[model samples]
Target: MAFIFESDLKAFLFCLLQFVIAIVVSYSFSNYTNPEQRKLEKVAMLELKVEQTEKDIEQLRDLTRSLEGKYQNIESVHVPLVAFHVYNPLHTNLEVGQVIVYQTVPLNEGNGYDRKTGIFTTPVTGLYQFSAHICNQDNAMFVYAIVLEGETIALSTQRDMPSSCNTVNALTVASAGQQVSVQGVHMSKSYQVIENPHRKNSFNGVLLHRT
Candidate 1:
């Protein structure tokens, strides 16, 4: 009976050792990760980086376009407004071949006009529009002309008409400091430009377009 109990004890100790070894192997295997799952995680990280890089490139392109627009605006030319209008309220006429000095100035932008000299000096080099209104009385024939630097550019003729008015216009390209004026011209004898209570002579100029 003692010999039988000794053999049973040895078999029980061997079985317990085998069970502990199997549990340790299973726990180690459960902790191990698959190689395919690691590769998939790396690929997902690369995809996120590529998406962020694409967004950065798009933002850079937008900034380039904005800079290009501002550069174009900087290269463009800027034009200014220049204009003047003057007229004499005196009830008397001006002398023939004499510059009409309009004393009462309603508008004189740029301060380029001189009322004492009856000249409108150009403030800038640009295209200019000039106009004049001439009035006469007592059936006196008179011719008026818009002069630029001693050259006539426009004219209006009154042929023996009593209390008549005529309007003349001139479009010219003028340089800075050039003078513009209205004068009576092409008359056999000296005549007067009429300005009375019934009529008023006017001279005006404006910068139509800048070049």
Candidate 2:
């Protein structure tokens, strides 16, 4: 009876040792695998954040390029221009309603004024200021008109005198291709005269504002 009890105690201890070994191995494996799984999850989240940041940076670059292109286009199209000044020192004869053509050009920026035809053509739509100085050396009367598109807008008249000077100026809006000129009106004498270089009979036009 004593021998049987001793053997049963030995067998019980052996089974208890096996159960403790299984519990220790299970706890060690759980501890090691849990940390590795958490690390993998964190790595995945960081990679996703990095991808989102890259996409945001690309979008910003595209917007900047678009704005730069628009600025370049604006710079190419919007340019300011148009100015001219002409003079005539030689003597000229004109009949009724004849244009007083200038033969000398001091400054013609946009080439809007024609010396031979005595006319100015606008290059752009804008407000323009025009002026004319008429000098008569002869004793006869001299009269001139500033004409825009064949209509007299301003007039300058000088009576019979040894030396006479008359000036006329006008401010008006003009479109592209519109014509402006100075015309002579018939007085008691048939000739309209321009004196020497000192008299400086001149005509000038300038652009004030662009529409």
Candidate 3:
């Protein structure tokens, strides 16, 4: 009886060991032989990533195309607004009320602002480039380049020391009309007409340019 019980116990232990071994072997074999499953999963992940990349590339292409169209449109128009005023020799001492026309005027009264001498208001919307020169008047004479958009100062320069009489100083403005002016004491004693008398005072309007 003792021998039979011992034999039974031995058989049971052996069976349990075999079952554990079989389970381990089956699990290992399943992982090894089915590498294709893992490969398929990797391929699916790669395909998904590639699809996302393609979508991103498409979006970038669209942005580039849109920018190109705008760039072309900008390239077409290229007009610049140019403005120049002649220095006045008689401007030895410009008084408070002394007024001068810097550009040509139509039948209408030109819109010129006298915040200071050598300055004018823009009557129309357009690019307004400004320039000026002074002569005879030494360091004592000065030309102030005060360019304004509405009441905003876009550019300002004071030519306290100028070399030539016909020297040129300038500024540019946008829109049909705006206000621009210079600040300086002119040689009120004497003045000369600019070569282009039409654009002498505040008569000439600047041309609009596409940037």
Instruction: Name the top TM-score candidate.
Output: 2
Listing every candidate in turn, what is its Cα RMSD in Å to the true structure after a full C-alpha superposition?
7.1, 4.8, 13.3
Give per-residue CA lDDT, model 1, range 128-174, as digits (tens): 99999877655677788999999999998886555688899999999
TM-score, structure 3 vs. true? 0.35
lDDT (tens digit, per residue) of candidate 2 on 110-146: 8999887889999888899999998875787778888
Which residue runs does candidate 2 get wrong by more than 4 Å? 1-79, 89-91
Rank order (by lDDT, best first): 2, 1, 3
User: TM-scores, in order shown?
Assistant: 0.61, 0.68, 0.35
Model 1 TM-score relative to the real fold: 0.61
How many residue pairs clash in all the candidates, one count each?
Answer: 0, 0, 45
Q: Which residue pairs overlap in candidate 1's backbone? A: none
- The C-alpha lDDT values of all candidates are 0.81, 0.84, 0.49
Model 1 Cα displacement at 142 (Å)? Answer: 1.0
